[model samples]
Target: MKLNAKGALLHRQLYVLLKEQIVTGRYRAGDLLPTQEALCQQFSISRITVRRALADLGEDSFIQNRQGVGAFVTANIGKTKHGPDFSFIGEMRRALKETTMQLLLLETQRCPAAIAAALGLADHEQALHVVRTRSQADEPVALLDGWIPCRFAKAVTAEALKTKSLHELIAGSFEQLGRVAQEVNAALADPIVAQALNIEINSATLKIDRLVHNREGAPVHYVTVLTAPMRTRLVMEVAADDIDGYNVGRLLHDVQQPKAPRRRQP
Candidate 1:
């Protein structure tokens, strides 16, 4: 691996490479990681940089560092038994059988600025907000917060939310469930969320943000879901043909071409 002078980039590169190795089973759980000096020589980086990368891996619960001894893999990364598929449509279909939702809060309130924008609502517009905890086999696994426009708020009720997934409720209210845009990000749980999930404060969590559109392509609702890392794993399956449609050949050609520098203004 080549080490760049850029400190942050260099650190991240080493971390990602080691993480990939561990996740791909090249370095199995309980396997000892290379010593700091060895890693430094392999990457041609300083001990400080190696330590920084290792620290990040430790914080994320991928490895454990022992004083005088080397770091060892703590958990089996990329391995889960019957984990929920990361696709929204797939997960919703499995929700009723695999999990249950307990309604925590249901009320009409002024939508938060960020959520309002996602739902295509004017600033300060009132919206229906619902909060619930999703559990599997009686163990809390996720916390969901959803916001829908006031026009459709009346249709959602506490009783209904307990028996149905948010998507199911939304689908019943809309003519069609149009395209859904989703983003998954890594985050640490705040105090309130940590307590709700019965996990330690600042524990690793997955934050999924979704925006649903109606049949006419109008925004329908915005949702944010938080899940503990230990209890949930997100997986996405894509076919080879689907990957080929990305036009990687064209992208590689564009990447190989150099760009001319823009002329400076007088």
Candidate 2:
């Protein structure tokens, strides 16, 4: 690819060139782009220039950077279909009877800085924290952490969380819980997540962040769910109709009867 680096617009030119390759199907979906060093050599640009271009592409959702791995074209590129979003609890049950939850940690405490910001908690506000390991057929799949405002803390308990979907629980107690806004990204597996999910450090983890809202357009809860890329698939169809409104988290799988949670590994 020939890149223009005249004056002070080299990075912008590189960004456009890479984006063109992606849009024109030259790179295609999920194709890893050349490494920064390779790009630097090919385009005769500095590392900073290549980094800037890649950052812009990633932020635009044209590419995803896998930690310890090179950047890749987004899998969603050029697709014309989107999936209907549904509650994970319901979807998990419908997809596999073998799916179960192992409660890791559930507590009520003051929101941490990051959690507070995501959930829009006030200063000194309390939030309910629920951590669980989700699995199917005794095989671990995901690590989930949900934070809800303290205003609703009294309504949720460890026992109450044991059997039903969190969506159903919130809808029953609250008046107008509605759609959720979510973003998915790739991240390195941290020590806690790696240990709980039985994966290695720097392993590929699909990080999903969600902001649940009530019907009044008010944000009610914020959740972060991390899963192994190998164990889970993220599929969404793209279309003009999708732009109007579409569910983004529906899992495409077989429905079956619910089963029991498995014992922990010794």
Candidate 3:
């Protein structure tokens, strides 16, 4: 109802209001929300203002807009978790049992400049970049892009790649996967990913940037995992020691990947 600095109506604020209600369970999932016209008239604002507020809600997966129908509350709003790795691959499977994975393209190539930085490598250093599409049931869910330093790449075969655990492959090759650092945030799916996932160009997804280390505490791998939002949720649990040790520095709040058998959707 209030106008923000841009002299535009404060849709983000209004979005928060509606979102809070849903999160608190006041407005149950599948409950129909006020129509654009009704909201505009109620707030004494223009339809554009109402639309903006609704769009903000839609963007965050707080609600769904049905064409020619009405906007309905979504069941997947606050259920998403932003936390530590705590086993990301397993968390994803628990969130969506219908998950499946297929190697879109896998080959050995010199790591690109961008990829090198991602993997913490020197220029001209060789690494293997494996690209694959992960789906939930039949729908594409995420694009798993992994960069493995060549030293460890030899351990990962095409057959091995088809399995569920890249972490296992790395751990098997080396002695252990001592530590891992990851960053998770919201991002728009790029064109290639959008097309492959059958989502919009700017569709929101969960992006996980990760780096793995060996027991000697040497950085061994870097990866970026992008996943679909609607059908997937992320979960993380923190231990008390992690808090006392100030381990929460680079381990800031939040939560990727595909491996394992394909399960039929229930």
TM-score against truth, every candidate: 0.61, 0.55, 0.64
Q: Candidate 1 residues 51-164, lDDT tens each?
A: 999999999889999988889998657574676565656677687678877888888889889888888889968898888888997889999888989776655787766666
Error of 3 at 223 (Å): 0.8
Error of 2 at 107 (Å): 1.2
Each model's lDDT comes to: 0.79, 0.76, 0.72
| Superposed model 2: Cα runs more than 4 Å off | 1-98, 173-176, 237-239, 242-266
lDDT for each residue of candidate 3 in 30-137, tens digit (9 for 90 to 100): 989988887776666678767888888898788999998888999765454345446645554443344666777667677768768866788878777778777755
Which 10 consecutive positions of candidate 2 have the poorest summed lDDT? 81-90
The candidate that wins on lDDT is 1
Can you write out model 2's per-residue Cα lDDT over 1-266, one digit (the tens) per residue?
Answer: 55665644788779878987887678989899999999999988899999999999999899999889999999878554324355444454464445787888878888778779877777688888888888876778888888888765556676877776565566553345666678788899999999978887777699988888877666677888899875676655545555544443454356896888898999
Q: How many clashing residue pairs appear in each of the predictions shown?
A: 0, 5, 6
The TM-score of candidate 2 is: 0.55
lDDT ranking of the models: 1, 2, 3
Order the numbered candidates by TM-score, best leading.
3, 1, 2
